[model samples]
Target: MEEGIAIRAENICKSFGEGDSYIEVIKNASFTIHKGELIALIAPSGGGKTTLLMMIGCVEEPSSGKIWLGDKQVFADKWLTRETRKIRREKIGFIFQAHYLIPFLNIIDNLTLLPQANKTDDKTARAKARELLKYFDIAEKEKAMPSQLSGGQNQRVAIARALVNEPQIILADEPTAALDMQRSVDVVKMLKQIALEQKVAIIMVTHDERMLPYCDRIMKIEDKTTIFEEQQLQKNSTHSD
Candidate 1:
């Protein structure tokens, strides 16, 4: 793997079912994403943007391809190891439209869950959770239940929870979809901040064009393949120059 590259996908393809019922979602899609970058992935509904994100996140198996996270090859035709759950827990963070915070747990507890499951001491987990809450500007809501916080606040906590594991890659599926325009913009800005400050690679799946400007680059899924928009533009411009 090249230095600073956070994710690399080579000739990736995905399909569902088999024989007559098989449906292909992605094919020959290859791309590299570097650390400290926020990438917007856009496609029409049913266009497999989410599928590509999932494949990179290790939640969905690619029918054929190779995927590398950081410096390690995690998948080649099939997963390199069977411990994908461990891989995800240690390497990837996920955000979704629904915040998915545990309703019964307080904000602090929700954030501490993953660390504690990895055998981190309770005190250490609590301290880490508090630090993340403070970073997200929701320190005061640490003890609040998900119901007590606004949607945006809950989403903040959700983002904090994702970072509790300090993942190298974050796969966000329509994270700002439910928020209003202002809040959506705020969330994307926050994501951009996280990518730069935390030096994590973030792939955000979104349908909203308004959010694209906040990203460092755009990855478009069309015709069952991936395109890096800015790189292509740069290449074209260099030729025309």
Candidate 2:
């Protein structure tokens, strides 16, 4: 793998069932996601978008092929390391369609809980959580419960929670699926900013074509294979210059 490549998958294949009942969801799918890039994954329903993301996140195993996270070859036909949970905790962050915050906890506590669970001291965890909240422009809502915030505000808090651990890669599954058009755009823009500012690789699975413009690149899966489509933003920039 290259020095700054955060994720690399080679000849990955995932299948379910056996013999006559077998079904291959991903076949020989391969791609590389570099640091400081926001990549969108798009495909039809049952097209294996989530399966590919799950494989990379170490939540699901590929039936065959190799997977690399950063410089480590973590999966080759089977997981190389037994510490999948630890790897997920330290190196990967996940954002889903739902905010999934603890309903009973207030915003600040919700953000601080995970870090505290990971053994970070309360003072440091609280400080980090506050810093992230401020960065997301929701610092004043620290005491507000999830139910009190607007959808966008709740999503921002979720993003803050995802970043609190400072993971190198963020795998987002349909993150904007529940938001309005404007809010969706805002969230995608925020994700792009986060990718560039933090130099973290973000692979987002989305069905919304309008959100593709905010991404650096797009990967579409079909028939168990993957294809890359560049955004051409740089091309337009050079032409405008």
Candidate 3:
């Protein structure tokens, strides 16, 4: 069986500048994410939610602390390797508020781009892309352009693209922001299912409290510190549907 813990961060701090011009955004932020968990990261705007997520994704450097992805300690104040991009592409999947699909390419092509960049063979990448499209129930739209898809469908494609690499963790930044209320709820439920079924830990940054009832835990930034609140599973499941 695979280990359940996917991410572990200890006493992380992120600051910009130094001396008189210094500003601290995150102070001693620490948390853990386990596989099969869907966690919501909520806070007021500009409260370091995205900053913390980016640090975990290895896109941003932390001023201090330790970060472990799966069993690998990727950061201890400084990055362990110059191959941060490679580590990110391989271990972490990212979903953004915007679909950001390549408008010029067909759905399959857009989905295959990442794997291809990682040097996956054309045939294998195509096969994986088709499988993900089918898993998301968009297989028939494989050859269609991004402009031809509905908002929900396009977002699904974007998520499929994220998962095509078979990452251990997913970092979603306001993934449901552009959708209607019902669509947003549906998307969150799907994310919950994905986390459990795929056994991939997921952390989503959002301001939507409606999403809170679906998440297993809520991580919040309050007064420059990060804290986790475990959800009532009964209440969460009730609201999720």
Q: After superposition, how far is residue 218 of candidate 2 from its true place, in Å?
A: 0.6
Clashing pairs in 3: none
Q: How close to the true structure is residue 55 of candidate 3, measured as C-alpha lDDT? A: 94
Q: How do these models rank on lDDT, best leading?
A: 3, 2, 1
- Location of the lowest summed lDDT over 10 successive residues in candidate 1: 232-241
The local distance difference test score of each candidate is 0.89, 0.90, 0.90
The residue ranges of model 3 lying beyond 4 angstroms of the native Cα positions read 234-241
Candidate achieving higher lDDT, 1 or 3: 3
Residue 5 lDDT (model 1): 97
1-241: candidate 3 lDDT, tens digit per residue? 1368899999999999989999999999888789988999988988998899999999999999999999899999899999999998899899999898999999999988889889999999999999989988999999999999999999999999889999999999999999999988888888888888899999999888888888889998998888889896544453345
Model 2, global lDDT: 0.90
Residue 219 Cα positional deviation in candidate 2, in Å, after optimal superposition: 0.4
lDDT of 1 at 196: 78
Query: lDDT for model 3, on a 0 to 1 scale?
Result: 0.90
On residues 1-241, what C-alpha lDDT tens digit does candidate 2 reach at each position?
A: 5799999999999999999999999999989999989999999999999999999999999999999999999999999999898888888888989899899999999988878868999999999999999999899999999999988899999999999999899999999999999899889888888887888999999999988877889999977899999885542221232
Show the colliding residue pairs in model 2.
none
Superposition error at 11 for model 3 (Å): 0.8
lDDT of 1 at 178: 88
After best superposition, candidate 2 residue 239: deviation in angstroms? 18
